[model samples]
Target chain A: MATATVILLDGLAYGMVLFIISVGLTVTMGLMRVVNLAHGGFAMAGGYLAAMMIRAGVPFFAAAALATLAAGILGGIAEMTVFRPLYRKGELAQVLMTFGLTFVFIAALTWLFGTDVKILPIPSYLAGPVDLGFRTYPTYRLFLIVVGLLLFLLVWFVIEGSLYGARLRAAVDNPRMARAVGIDVNRLFTITFVIGCALAGFGGVIGAEMLQLDPFYALRYLVLFLVVVAVGGLGSFKGSFVAAITLGVVETAGKFLFTDIAAFLLFALVFVLLLWRPNGLLPPKSVA
Target chain B: MNPAWHALPWLLAIAFYFTAGGYLSLGTSILVYILLTLSLDLALGYAGIITLGHAAFFGFGAYGAALFAIHVNADPLLGLVVATAVTAVFAVVTGMLILHTQGVTLLMLTLAIAVLLAEAANRAYKVTGGDDGLQFTMGPVLGLFRFDLWGQTAYLYTLVILFVWFVIAWKVVHSPFGRSLDGIRQSQARMRAIGTPVWWRLIAIYAISAAMAGSAGALSAQTTRFVGLNTLGLLVSGIAVVMLVLGGTRRLYGAFLGAAVYVVVQDFAAKVNPFYWMFVIGGLLMATVLFLEGGLMEVLDIGRRWLRRLLRGSDPT
Candidate 1:
């Protein structure tokens, strides 16, 4: 019972982090039909940025904010430079181009950082564990859960309850019709790309401690995050949240229970899910 | 012009293979990629399958053949058979699932499948020799020819396999079935409307492509004497696609020429400056996407055309 509770909490925390990392990829793929393989590069850029700032003696929160904003800007640039041109190409070209971008980003990053693993220092305020009758869990982990939930709700509000989201939805549902109706799709693509990268950036800063920084860290984690998107079904933010959490639980439990099994069983699970439902567990109704 | 004059390209490739000093291994690598790329070209460029993870089959071929050689002590030829069988089975299983979707969903499914295979290879350290990769101790070609340390037998063997596949691919591309595939690539719905079983054609093409990829994998393992997780990684898949695109995807011989160019560039560039090789490749890719559009083969064709025009300028009106 005690282990179950611990697993549940850890699973939720891990899931939230996965959701944050993958939500951007979901949006870009869904809205733009661009398989941005470099989506994880944005996360890496954000994490590295925050780490650089923190190392320079800036406050942690301020460093994280700056990093997130920079990631958003970088995302906007990527939108303008890369994806816009690719929007007209076939799926293979887009996949290859984005995958090429990932290679460039990774090679450049490794050249710059020298392949040393950087550890983010957990703030002093959140170092200790909070008492919970059966077991004490780290406060920082709980904080991550809270932040993830808040972001989830925030994205939900923006996507579901806002006029901007309505316009984006209309564009996704029928780009030609939306253009006929006077909605600017090009601008929406840029905005959606930026927002998606911002989410990934946030995940980078917050989850840096969890995902210890390494040269190919983005590449290593990319498949996992993509699995979340795949399992959840692309284009549905809510589906991503649910899928991410489910994958987190399954992966975490697999780590604990089947130490002898290959680590990729979790990925195999996603592969099976994809086979079962090619569009994912909850495919988006709209296609821009 | 005599019809036999059109065979000039094959004659040239054979001459290059025989006499292109210090290019035997590089030529062989190109042949391997030509086979791999042509296999992919059949499915993706011709059939419009959009398989983003085709390297999985290639890796499966390498690993399966390597394992068969190591454990079953099978002949290299038999190992190729086993590899194809395994890859075909895997393709049928994954293709059935992946082919259900259209567009981006298909792309993601392919990526996911490849990543899963790579991850499995990574995690199964003992089985796959882990990051160190799987090394092979092989006998020879068909139990007759020995694998020379200098890669002589490997080169000739790879060339023969490549030529055979190329001829097969060539014949198929010009056949009725091949035209049907092109029709499907243009519009699947229309093909179905015209009484073609679009799905079955796709499965058949995917199976054939898997067999080709597996053949390359077997040949690569036989020649290179090693197979690693990198075989299934995104890098391999991405590079294959890059090579295909660089060659002129829609053209039959484009993949071959593209593979040759890509391998040569990698070899010479890394020798020139290892530190800047990636940057150069990235820049080349960016340039290719932006300007050439038709790939390196197209560039060569244009240059050849210009050269002929220049030579004829004063002689002809």
Candidate 2:
């Protein structure tokens, strides 16, 4: 029972990180239909920047904020340039182009940081254990859960409860109609893309302890992000949340109970879940 | 192409053997990669099955062939046949599972299957030799020619097999069934409306492609006498796609050009600096998508047209 509780908490924290990173990809592929395979590269960029700042004696929160802002600026520049041309191309072209972009990011990071895994140490406030009523749990994980839940709430409200979000949804549902209504769908998408990449950057800053930062960070964890988005039904935020948590728990449990086949079982779950859901657990209303 | 054109590549291969003597093993690898890329074209270029899991079939074939050599038989031909059969069976099962989904869902399914197989191969260290890799000695080809250090026999044997497969691929690509596959790729709904068995055709072509990839994998194992976990890695799959795109899809000859350039360039670049190759490959991929849509073959076509115009200098019309 004790072990199960510990696994559940760890899994939740891991899932929260996945959700944050994958939500960006969900926006790009699901809402925008661009199939940007380099989304993880942005996350890696943020994490790497934050790592450098912290190593140079910047405070943890300040480092994360600067990294996120820089990542957003980078996204904005990418949008106005290379990615702008790709919005009109086919998925295959997008895939190949973004794959090239990813390779470039990996190569760049390797040159800058060397091939070794880079560490991002959490601040003392969030480090060590905290006493719960029943048992002691890591303060860092509790912070992750709090941050994930808060972000989910904020994102849900912005996307579902605000006029801007309604316009964003309108653009996604039918770009022509949105354009006809003078929505400036292109601008809306650019904003969303920038915000999504920034969130991915923030996720990287906080989740570095779990996912680990390396030159190959983008490629190594790409499938996980894609799986979460696919299982969540692409454009659906709520489904991403649920699917991320479920997969995280399943992966964590597999590691705890069947260490020898942990990765195999995780992949097997992906296969079966996808077979069962196809479009995912909760496809967006337009798709449904 | 004219009947005489069939022997051009073979002639080059032979000439290369005498000229580049010590580099015959590298030449052998180029041939093996060409066959693998050719097989990918059948499913991806011809059938339009968007996937990144082709390496699963190739790696499984290597494992299958290596285990066959270790336990049951040491004859290279028999191992190749066994490996092909095993991989084809595996493809049939996975194709059924993954082909039902479309687009992103489909892509993820294929990736999942590949990762699952790789993980299984990793854990079964006793059988696959895991990270240390599976190594074995291959018997003489057809029980007559002995395996040599200079790779003289390996190059010729691989060239012969590649030629046979290339001919078979040519027939398949030009056949009526191949025409139907073109239809499906262009308009799946139209093909379905016209009563074409879309799903079955996909599975069949996937199996055939898997068989070819398996044979290539088996050949690689036999020639190199080793099968490492990296054989099943995403890098191998990605590199295969890179080669296919570099040459141009739907043209079988493209595989030959792409694989040769990729292998030779990688060999040279790695010697200079390992990371330098990534920049070159990545830049090439971007250039191919952005400006060179039809790849190197398209450039060659344009060059030939220019040459024709140059020959008819006086004809303004």
Candidate 3:
């Protein structure tokens, strides 16, 4: 019973982090039809920036916020400049270019901060244990759950309830028709891409403890993020939410139960699931 | 135009032997990289198999050779044959399972194979030496020319093997089967409509490419006497892609130029700072994809055309 509870809470926290990091990749892939392999680079950028700021005497939360915003700005600039040309290119070019960008990001990070791992220290309030009615838990885990749920709701409201959400959905379903119906799909992509980048950055700063922050952070955790996106289906936000949770629980369970073969099992599961549903569990109507 | 030009690279290798006092091993590794890239071109450039996990076979080849040396026989030739055979068989089985899937799924599956193999190797530490890497000494080639302290035998041995593979690759690219592969690359459906067994053909080429890659891996292990876990890493596969792309895919000699340039640049870049290599390679990759689509080969072709026109003093129609 104790193990179950621990696994559940930890898995939920991990799932939230995965969702926050990978949702952007799914969105950008769906929107641009380009495999942006450098998406993790933005996440790493945010983590490194936050680490730098925190080390320079800024409060942790403020540093995280600033870093998230900076990541968004960086993403926007990248989308406008480097990513713009990719829209018309083939998959080969897209993969090659984005993968190249990842190397550059790693190089820059290494040049700036050396290759040592950096950690983001949580405040005392968040670091301490909190008493649940049934059991005691770390305050940080609970905080992650709350923050993740709130962010989910906010994203849900934006993507489902708002008029902008309708337009975005239309664009995702069928971009040509969406444009024919007077929706500015390009601008929609930019807005959504920026928001997605910010979310990844936010995830980076918060999830750094579990994922770790180093020069190779971008490429190191790439497989995990890509798996989340793949399992969740490329274009579905709610799908990513569910997939992240499931993968988190399965991974956490595997870690405790089958220590050596956990990664192998997870990758094998991806292959099986893909074979079962090539389009993913929850695919959009007309995936480009 | 001149058949004599074919021997130029071999000539350079023979000259490099005496002149390059301390860099023979570097030359040997360059030959290995060249072989790896050439194998990748056969699949990626010719057959349109977009894989990111070619390093898996390379790693398998290395492990197979290393283990064979340690346990079975220390004969280099026997180990090479065993390693290549095992890698090709593995590729055959994997290709059967994965060649049906196209696009994103195919890409992910290929990557998964490499990751799973790496993980498996990491866990079986006793055999693989885990992250510490596997080290083994082997008998000299045919018990004749021993691996010398100066690495002269290793360089010559690798060069001869590279030349053999290069000839094979050249012949394979110009053959009927290679043309069929080109058709499949252009349109798998069209090839299928014409009674071509698309999946089986892919499997065949994949096995051949794997065999070549495995041979390179075996060569690396035999020459260096060590196999690092990084032989199976995504970085190695990514570097192969960069090298092949840089040299120009579809052009047989691209691997030679790409490997040489990449190694030279990497040597210089690493001297400045360890991280500078990444920036240089990354910048070169982007530039190649965006501007120099045909890679340095296109530039060379244009130069050749200009030179011919200049000498002839007229349009060379």
Candidate 4:
């Protein structure tokens, strides 16, 4: 019973991080119609940057902030350069180009980083454990839960309440009409991509302690990340939130329960979900 | 000018080059790769099926051949035949279910299928030898000729197989059935409207291509005497697509040209600087995508057309 509780919390914590990272991907794919294989690259860059800064004696929060900013910059540049050209092309070109960029990023990073698994230490402030009546959970893990909730609410408020969010909503619904209404569609797209990358960067900082800072980790975890996005559906925030948490818990618990069959089962779920919904669990079909 | 007299000297020179250069093994590998690339051309270039899991069929063939050889002690010819048959069956089953999805969905599904098979191979330690990979001591060829490590015998075998496959592929490409495939490529909706069974045709093409890929794999395993997980890895599948694109899609000889360029560049570049080969490949792809709109074949065609014009200078009809 205690083991079950522990697994549930652990899964939730992991799932929250996946949620944060994949929400950005879901949004970009929803608005831009580009399958950014380099989305994981942004997470990687942020994790690496945060690790380097932490090793250099910078505070974790400050390092994380800088990493998020760096990711946003990289995302903006990718939008302007690689993605802009493929907007008018087919989905195959978009997938291929992004895949090409992914290889380039992996090769370049491997060349620089020497393939070793780089570690990030858990910050002192968030170190130790909290006693729950039956079991003790890591304090840092609890902190991530709190942080994750805050981020969820913040994103929800901004997306539902703010003017920029309204413009974004308009763009997601109909780009032509949004442009006709004098919204700078390109600028919104750039901002959205940057914001999505920045969220992935934040997820990286919190999630880095769990995942090793390695070159191929991005490729290794890419399918799962995509699974979260696809199961949640594009442009549907609520769907991503629910799907991400569900997948995180299921996958984490699956490894424990199913053992060797975890990966197959996880992928099978993705296939089944896609088959059922064609687009996703909850496609953005209302406004459009 | 007598035709026999004109071609006889060139044929003798070609024979001399093939004999002197020990070009058999290298030439055969090129031919096998040409077949693999042609199979990819049908799916990627013609059908717009952006598959990144093509190595699934290749690995399937390798394993299939090994299974046949180990259990039945089958002849090498029979091994390849069985391998192709198995791969075609697998392709049909998977392609029918997966090919209905378009774009990233299809890519992801294909990738998942490849990863599933690869992981299964990894976990089944006793059967596949797990991470160490599978090994087979191939029996005599066609129950007659013995296996030779020397380049000459191996090269001729592969070259002949390639030539035969090329002839068949050329016939298929030029036929009315192939033209129907072109129509499907342009628009599935229009083809469906015209009463073309788009889905079944796609499944058929995918199965045929998988069979060809499987043959390449069987031949490769037989010649090399070893097969690794990397044969089914993303890198091989990615490179095959890259080669096809570099050579230009929908062009017959383009697959051969692409494979030659890809293999030669990898071999040469690794010798020169192993670390920078990927950078070179990426740069080349970018250049091709940005500048060579129609791929390397288009550039060559333009050059040839220019040369012809220059040779026929001032001649007006």
DockQ, all models: 0.47, 0.80, 0.71, 0.43
For residues A1-288, could you state the per-residue lDDT of candidate 2 as single tens digits? 989999999999999999998888888989988888888998999999999999999999999999999888988887787688898887667888888888888988888889898899899989999998789999999999899989999999999999999998898778899999999988898899999999999999999989989988999988889889989987888889999999899999989999999999988988898899998888887877
Per-residue lDDT of candidate 4, residues B1-317 (tens digit): 23453344235424743684665566667767888998888777777777888899988998888878877875788888899999999999999898887766677778778877877777677888878887878877767677776655555556666666767777777788788889988898999999999898889889988998898888887777777777777676877887887788888567876887877777677677654666567667656655665678888778878877987896765
Against the true structure, what is every candidate's RMSD? 2.6, 1.8, 2.0, 3.5
Candidate 4: clashing pairs of residues = none
Clash pairs for candidate 3: none
lDDT digits (tens) for residues A1-288 of candidate 4: 997887788888888888888877976776788877778888888888888999999998899999999988988888888888877876655665676677677778778876788787888878988899988989887787778778888888988899998998888888899999999998888888889999888787788866567887667777777778777777777778878888877878888898887776776777777767766777776421
For A119-221, candidate 1 gives per-residue lDDT tens digits of: 7777899989999877799999999999999999998898899999898878877899999989998888788889889889889989987877765776778
List runs of model 4 lying over 4 Å from the truth.
Answer: A286-288, B1-29, B314-317
- Number of the candidate with higher lDDT, 1 or 2: 2
Better of 2 and 3 by TM-score: 2
TM-score versus the correct structure, for each prediction: 0.93, 0.97, 0.96, 0.91
Query: Higher-lDDT candidate among 1 and 4?
Result: 1
TM-score winner: 2
Alpha carbon lDDT of each predicted model = 0.81, 0.88, 0.88, 0.78
